[model samples]
Target: MPRTSTAVIARAKGAPVELATIVVPDPGPGEAVVRVQACGVCHTDLHYREGGIGEDFPYLLGHEAAGVVEEVGPGVTDVAVDDYVVLNWRAVCGQCRACRRGRPWYCFATHNATQRMALADGDPQAGTELSPALGIGAFTEFTLVAAGQCTKVDPAAKPEVAGLLGCGVMAGLGAAINTGGVTRGDSVAVIGCGGVGAAAIAGARLAGANRIIAVDLDDRKLATAQELGATHTVNGRDQDVVAAVQALTDGHGADVVIDAVGRPETWQQAFYARDLAGIVVLVGVPTPEMRIPDIPLLDVFGRGGALKSSWYGDCLPSRDFPLLIDLYLQGRLPLEAFVTETIGIGDVEAAFAKMHGGDVLRSVVTL
Candidate 1:
C-alpha cells in the first residue's frame, strides 16, 4: 500500500512552502523507505523554494536528515531494516570515473531513489512528481531514497543532532580537514561564521590548528565559533579581515583561509589572507549572477597555493558519517550545540526566516 505522509512542498518559485499530503511508494529495487525522525532546515532548501537550484517545481524540501530504515529493496545489503541512519546526497556509484580512481568523494555520478514521491492532493492514484531536495527530501514522516543514501550509525546518537552530519556540518568540517588540510600548529581563518564556517573552525581545532580565527559580520556567530574552538575572532564589518588574520598570525597570514561566504569579495579576502603557499577552500555557494572580476594573474603565480571548492566537503559518507557521530557521542565533538532549535514540519518557512536573519545555526524539523 502507498503511504500518505505530511510533507513540506514548494509548488512554484518564490512562493511559500505548504504542508501537503505526499504519497511515498514502497521500496523498489536499489531503494529504501526511511521513517524520517529529523531533518535540518538548510539554505539549499531555501534555494529550491526560490528556484535557484533548478526548474524542478513542486520540490519536496528538506535534507540533512537522519532516520530509521523501515524497508529496503532487493540487493540492498549495506543497510538493513530498523537501522538508525543518516541520509546523504552523495551515494557514490563505484563505477563512476572518480570512484574508479579511488576518489569516491569526487564521484561524478551519485545515485538517488529511482522512483519519485508524489503529491497526494488531486488523486491518490496519479499525483504530481515532486523533486526531492538534494535527493533526500525529508521534511516528512517518511521518505524514499536510494538504499546507499542511508549510512547506518550508532543508535545511541540523538536523531536531531546526528542528522546534521548528513550535510552542512560535514561540509564545514571537510572544508577544514579535507580541502584546506589544516594540520597541527597551522593557522586557519574561516570566513562567514555560519553553521558551516563554525564547523570548519571545529574541524581545524580537531586537526590541531594553533591559531583558529573566526571571521564574520555577526558577533553572535563569532561567539559561537569561539565555543567551537576558535582561538581568535574577527568581525568583518569592524576589521580588515586580511589584516586581522595576518596580525593574529604574526603578520605572516593564516596557513589556510576558507571562504564560506562564496561572494567575490569574500573569495578575494580568502585569496589574499592566506600565507605563502597556503591553501584556500571555497565552500560557499554563489548565485548565478555573481562573478569574480579583476583577479590578478600575477598573484595566482606568486601566491603558490591551492584554491579549492568543496563539494559537500569532499566527504565519503561511509567513512566520515560514523566517525563524526562517534566523535559527537564522545565529549570531543559538540553536535548538540549546532541545534539552535527544533520545530515541526510546518515551521520550515519560519525557519528559513531565522536562517536569513542569522539567528540559528540549524533549525531541525523533528518528525
Candidate 2:
C-alpha cells in the first residue's frame, strides 16, 4: 500500500522549500523503504532549489541521512528490515565499467528506486512526480531508495552524526585520505574550512599528516578547522594564501593541498600552494558557469605532480562508512563536533539562512 509522508520539496527554481504531503510507494524489486531518523541540511539541497543542479522543479530535497529499513523488496539481501543504515547516493551497479574493474566507487551506473514519490491527492500538484535529490530523497518521514543505497552501520552511532558520512563529510574525508593520499609525515593544506574542508583536516590528522594548515576567509570557520585537527590556520582575507601556506611548510609548500571551495580562485590557490611533485585535490563543487583558470600551459607541464577532482570524495560507501563509524564509536574520530545544531524538518529554511551567515557547520533535521 502507498503511504503519505510529510516532506520538503522545491516547487520551482529559487522558490522557498515548503512542507508537502507526498505519496511513498512500496518498495519494488531492488528497492527499500527507509524510515528516516535524521537528515542533514546540505548546500546541494540549496543548489537544487536554485536550479543550479538542474531545471528539475518539485525536487525532493535532503540526501545526507540515516534511518532504519522499514521494508525491503524481493531479491534484496544487502540489508534487512529494522536494520540501522546510512543512506548513500551511489548504489553501484556491478556491471558498470568502473565496478567491473574493481573500482565500484567510480561506478558509471548507480541505482535508485524505480518508482517515483508523488504529490498526494488534494494538493494543487497532486500526482506530480518528484525528483529526489541525489537519488536519495530523505527529507521525509519515510523515503524509498534502492536497497544498495542503504549501508548498514553500527546501531550505537547517533543518527545525527552518522548521517553526515552520507555526503559532505565523506567527501571531505575521502578527498584527503583516498584522493590526496595524505600519509604519515606529509604536510597538508586545506582551503575553505567549511564542513567539507574541516572534515578534510580531520582526515589529514587521522592519516597522520605532520602539519595541517587550514585556509579560510572566515575566522570562526578557521577556528573550527583547528579544532577538527588543523595544526595551523591561515586567514586568506588578510594574507596571500599561497605565501602563507608555503611559509608554514618551510618554503616547500604542502605535499597535499585540497580545495574544498571549488571556485577557480581556490583551485588556483591549491595548485600553487603545493610543493613541486605535490598533489592537488579538488573536492569543492563548481557551478556550471565557472570555467577553468587560464594558467600557462607550460605551468601545467612544469608541475611534476597529480591534479585530480574528487567526486563524492571518491568514496566506496560499503567500505568507508562502517570503518569511519567504528572510528567514531571508538572516540578516534570527532564526528559529533560536526553537528552544529539539530533542527526540526520545518526549520530547514531557517537553517539555510544560518548557513549563509556561516553560523553553523551542519543543521541536522531530526525526525
* lDDT tens readout by residue for model 2, 308-361: 999899999999999999999999999999999999999888988999899999
TM-score per candidate, chains pooled: 0.98, 0.99
What tens digits encode model 1's per-residue C-alpha lDDT throughout 1-367?
Answer: 7799999999989999998898999999999999999999999899999999999888999999999999998899998999999999999999988999999999999999999999886644348999999999999999999998999999899999999998899999999999888899999999999989989999999999999999999999999999999999999898999999999998988999999989999999999899999898999999999998588899999989898999999999999999999998887999999999999989999999999999999999998
lDDT of 2 at 173: 99
Off by over 4 Å in 2: none
Clashing pairs in 1: none
- lDDT of every predicted structure (CA atoms): 0.93, 0.95
Positional deviation of 26 in candidate 1, in angstroms? Answer: 1.0
Instruction: Give the 10-residue window scoring lowest on summed lDDT in candidate 1.
Output: 119-128
